[model samples]
Target: MQLLLAHVTGIQLSVRGVWELLRTHGWSCRQPARRAIERSEAAVAGWIKETWPSAKPLPRRSGPGSSSRTRPLSR
Candidate 1:
């Protein structure tokens, strides 16, 4: 992507060259979410529900105020 743009614009850069540039500039690729080894799925869900707008994001015009979204529990 960026390498393509650079090459077309006469910058002359390869994928490896871009990688080297990033490394030299002390930049790193994005990383995944870091979770504890002893993560509790139920606890995480509970936390999300309790802390997320208090719940999930409800669709628009679902009958409610804008304070937060009330998510219906799925069976």
Candidate 2:
């Protein structure tokens, strides 16, 4: 759950937040290092999976001077 929250939300919520949420629900906090290690491993595994050979190439941009309507917006 914490791993999902951290990955999906992209927020590095503190250990205190995790502890408080668990405590509120009458659950005990797991070791902080264990949680951190799990999260880190999950993140690395995700990255590896995402960057594997099957990954699609990013779309190429048209590059500089490719557009004709170039007047500055501020002017």
Candidate 3:
């Protein structure tokens, strides 16, 4: 509202009013993701078991110290 107030000369709009207008226009409120509705549980489970492991694979520790850049550069 602070940013919007600057653009208008005298119009007053509250956060509640803005949300009401968005709702009236068939807009969803606070939907972070829609996958829970469209995606199936079995498919998600399968991906987690198969594709997810490869997609976000655990770090290949080149024997522990090799992966740690925070250690002394010479060490």
Residue 52 displacement in candidate 1 (angstroms)? 14
Q: Which is the better candidate, 1 or 2, if ranked by lDDT?
A: 1
The root-mean-square deviation over C-alpha atoms between each candidate and the true structure, in angstroms, is: 12.8, 11.5, 8.0
Local distance difference test, per candidate?
Answer: 0.75, 0.70, 0.70
TM-score of every candidate relative to the true structure? 0.32, 0.28, 0.34
Please, what are the lDDT tens digits per residue for candidate 2 over residues 1-56? Answer: 67776998886667788778778998874655535544677677888888764687
* Ranking of all candidate structures by their lDDT, best first: 1, 3, 2
Give the runs in model 1 whose Cα sits over 4 Å from its true position. 3-9, 32-75
Greater TM-score among 1 and 3 belongs to 3
| Regions of candidate 3 where Cα sits further than 4 Å from its true position | 1-29, 32-38, 60-72
Error of 3 at 48 (Å): 0.5
lDDT of 1 by residue, 7-68 (tens): 67778677888788778988889785797899999998888778887466687765544544
Better of 1 and 3 by lDDT: 1
Per-residue lDDT of candidate 3, residues 1-75 (tens digit)? 534753774656677776776689988657666555676899889999989878896888564354577775454
The candidate that wins on lDDT is 1
